[model samples]
Target: MADSKERLASSLLELKKYQEQNNTGVVRGSSTLGRTHLQRLVENGWLEPVMKGWYIPSSPEDVGTTSVWYANYWNFIVEYCNSRYGDDWSLTAEESLTIHSGNMVVPTQIVIRSTKATNNVVELKYGHSLLEISTSPASEVAFDPIYGIRLYGIAEALMFSSPNYFKSDPVNARANLASLENSAQIIRLASVNGNSSRVGRIIGALKNIGRDNIADEVLKFMQRLGYDIRVEDPFDNIVKVSASQSPYVSRIRLLWEKMRGQILSMNLNLSRIDLKDKDSVLRSMETNYVKDAYHSLSIEGYRVTESLIERVRSGAWNPDAEDTDRRNALAARGYYQAFMRLQKSMATCLEGDKFDLESELNEWHYELFDPCVQAGIISPADLIGYRTMQVYIKGSKHTPLPVNAVNSSIGALCEMIEEEKDGFIKAVLGHFFFVYIHPYMDGNGRTARFLMNMLLCSSGYSWIVVPVERRNEYMQSL
Candidate 1:
């Protein structure tokens, strides 16, 4: 008879083969032999039970991990959907938009669509839930071959989703729509009409492009059918007209006016200070630098003090000191380390041929954390955890970006900053984008502030620190 170890090894090999093929529903028998095998697999940390009778391959990293439930979620959902629904399962329009935006901030309740009825809210482990809603008769769905699932078209997606989804914080909603990098998708959305009343509202919500004509045409067609269409353009402060008032005409007209206003007000000029002389420029630069440092630290959730600033200025700051001043010392050291790294990054950028901002920023990040990582002040694992902890707040919803995407977004942002000519705009955008990307496991806000100062320094501007009092405004600006 085979020993327990031999049996365990055999069970592991079978499980691995199943996982490799992306098969999740294959049942191991419920006999004594099967129960023993599964128990051994779980005990040995080779498998994790996702739900009843379902198992996922587990790595050493997966044991006792609570933070990255979304990663595990994506894995389980992909497996579960494939096993149960095959190609019949699909994400809702809003979920599709979230995916299309390269946003990994998983929704609290993932909305999906299927031919079969499911519970409106299905709770998952780790405080996440999935809401599966049936698509309306007027809704249109299309197959996304990439994921082998059907999803609502952009036009259908906008129309079918709640108006509250677009109306909350109109600026961000408009920004998200405007920043859509895919032109073909936009055109496709513009071409579809009469699918949903929400399409008219979506057209009104879009910021850039002269697609009002298309929307107008669609609205005219919808109005001919006597649908009670009301366009909700949140960006405009116009009078709310009744739907009885030419709904199509009023909505499209207001959207066009708003679009024109946005186009006219799109300021590309970088803010500049009037310096009387080189000395004045130098003084202003210093002031801005200090301001930037203070604000950056404040935003990063630090309580800055004069002593900490002094230590940072002096170069004798230490994070591992065990005195009463340790916290302050650590803050000071972290600030200085970030500052020096920024200096080195800027210098490297100045010397480089390709103007590679992303590469330089990444190099700076490594340099900034090297000392802490080496001295055991913070471990490599913690550093990784810090980067993964970045959360993006959309209205009241907080979405955490996956670790892998954070790195990519950071690199992309650096490339964008390198292309910008306006120093103030560069600084502001860099700071916003860095925090938005949340690249590192931790220290992202500090790193971002350092980046802001570096950009300001390059252009002969002062460091601008945000005070703790203005934290709300700081986050709002971002």
Candidate 2:
């Protein structure tokens, strides 16, 4: 066993050096590493095979989780495409628009256009595949230099995107459309082809999202070009229009407007709990603590127990005195502390008073991770604010918003929560959107549950416990 571990460690060191030299997760089978090293790494689950000769860095712990694959998906595409076709390929218009809008959710299948493609599909792990369509690369291709995936420029992507695309994914379409800083690109492209029908839909889509001035510019430009156009809105429905030019904010507001109605229509009973019964509520919450902490912590992949939770709550678990078990105890202690803080905030809401919701949430996040910081398990900087890098959820296709989009999106979501009158709606959408944005690097699931229960408590709803047994369904529903 010692010999095997030493061999595995040596192989991992080699792989790490290769990753550092190449500065990528992707590893080609034909590279300098001999077959023996590749076989050992694969056996130990350190490298995941993408195809016959392609692999990406992974770990044994990530065996069942698709997060590794999703995280490295773009890197594989960039490496594979660059190897096969050099600089001759670009993503299809629809995919380009999706990226341009800052929605990095991994698609089940991505279509690529290239002068050298053979019009075939390259199957990837987790049922994701790449379809290559043979076509002359567009002159207006753009590149995301960081990922090295070529894409259609924003204006070109919007112009060439199918009419059905606007209706099929109005959220991304609306976002990218709103991202057009002015009408110059649209006017320049529309005037070249005299595409009256496409122009008409673009004009209506612009007006649909409350960009009427740009819409008018395109409209007048087309008319002056001696083209008769009948304007038509492509979207089947229009959500609330945000004045902010940010696509991420626009997407959040649109989703909130669209989903809040459904949440309200669920017809949940949200009567206020009488302040006289605050003691009863507190006792009930105390009664539910062990079960709640167990499931919430367990669902987040923490190995915790009811006894550990009880010990932490009763001050029997001390970080300073329990060095041998302190690593395992961090999550329990942090959760207990954060939950207590949450209950106090919830008590304030129970009094029907306004509080700084943002500050309250930040405290919840801080309390949840502060124990880890104190234990030297993670840097204290991690708890400072929202995540500074992209985060992929386990077994989920939904990629959280990029770091650049985190701040504004959170602000927009908080404003919506404050403006909302119904507690149940706030609870439902607040929980949904919080995880949707996935602002934090870790503890998002726990924090989201806290936010949900906080709103629920404010409206007299009993504390809802999501069971670990329903973990799969819980993730899918989110």
Candidate 3:
């Protein structure tokens, strides 16, 4: 029999091997992982069971982590469905439209369709469940894979989606419809399915979004084929938001609209924005810099101090002689530099909101990393923009949008803020959504807090310094 130390060594080696092969730490219980191995992991606090047969890896220190469910939600579905039904399964029409609209939030109740599905709900952790409905879908499906889960193509999804989708997620529905780009696809599907009612709904949706050309083409084609059609506007209100037809724009708009309500009330103590009080504004910003920098850097896991911040601010920053000093000093310097730029931007927004925002936001990212570049810690090529690859939060299950979606999300966010007159909403949503988007690889938290403060400054509110000690509270609120 193996001794305790030998057994532990064997377990550790096996765990490493499993994680390496899978790439994701998630493990199926029966494959290379036995009940003893799993129980050992549970004892060590390195694993959490999502369902009876599924387990997700976690850090021993990270006890009670449920976001693991959200993080791996779709991946688990893909694996589960594929194992059970091969390629004979896909997301239901409504769920497919949800993904197309860029709402990646994990649903509490997920619905899938498969020819070999069990047609029953399998309960998972946190009250979420997988409801798979068996359906005899044709072998050939116009489908796409998002984060591994297969779904109907945008056009097919839009073509088959219920009117309830238009009511609940109109922006998403319209965005998916806009992804169709042409009436030919819809016309073809309508002809093949021979569903005049669904085709009429699609035509109405196209017309509602001002796609007169496609709607007219589709209408004429159906008329030519001797089919009587009536367009159906699903929403009670005929009004449409002035949104670009680009799917990215529509998705971003939809997500922001759905998410904004949660964070709008986070800061309600601020007075009305008085950007005219320039001296008062500047003084408030200056007074808060040391505390702000200390808390912000510390929250980001930087070992920064008041002394270090002052040293960097006082032009006494010389960290080249020592390696650790160099890294910490660079962090302090970057914070100070970015803070100064933020002050200037706040002042400009006070006078007018007409600055080149894209360029300015890019400059903010560049300023934060320029210090790191100078210290030879990061590549200078990335000095001008957001991360071009995926990023995951350290401890949270919430994943950021895909890297490619960052630009459009930021653009839509800025446009929303620019058009709104409410300083409070701007501060709250701007801060929450910026970090939620996680646009930048390194400086997202610092930048988000800076934005929140700047928008607060517009309302004559004092800077709300989130202390390092309250980092847990800050992140949880996010």
The local distance difference test score of each candidate is: 0.55, 0.84, 0.76
Model 3 — TM-score against the truth? 0.83
**Tens-digit lDDT track of model 3 for 365-459:** 77777788887878889765778887777656567777777887788888887776776777777888788788887788988888888877866
TM-score of each: 0.53, 0.92, 0.83
Candidate 1 regions exceeding 4 Å error are 1-12, 23-37, 60-62, 134-150, 169-176, 179-196, 207-359, 362-432, 435-453, 456-478
**TM-score comparison, 1 vs 2, better candidate:** 2
> What's every prediction's RMSD, in angstroms?
10.5, 2.6, 4.1
lDDT of 2 by residue, 59-82 (tens): 899875787888888889889988
- Top-TM-score structure, candidate number: 2
Q: Sorted on TM-score, highest at the top, how do the candidates line up?
A: 2, 3, 1
Could you tell me which 10 consecutive residues in candidate 1 have the lowest summed lDDT? 241-250
Give me the runs in candidate 2 sitting further than 4 Å from their true place. Answer: 1-4, 144-146, 267-272, 275-284, 320-324, 352-354
Return the lDDT, model 2, position 21.
88
Over 387-463, each residue of candidate 1 has an lDDT whose tens digit, in order, gives: 64434342313244445455545554565566666666667667766665566655666677767776876665655
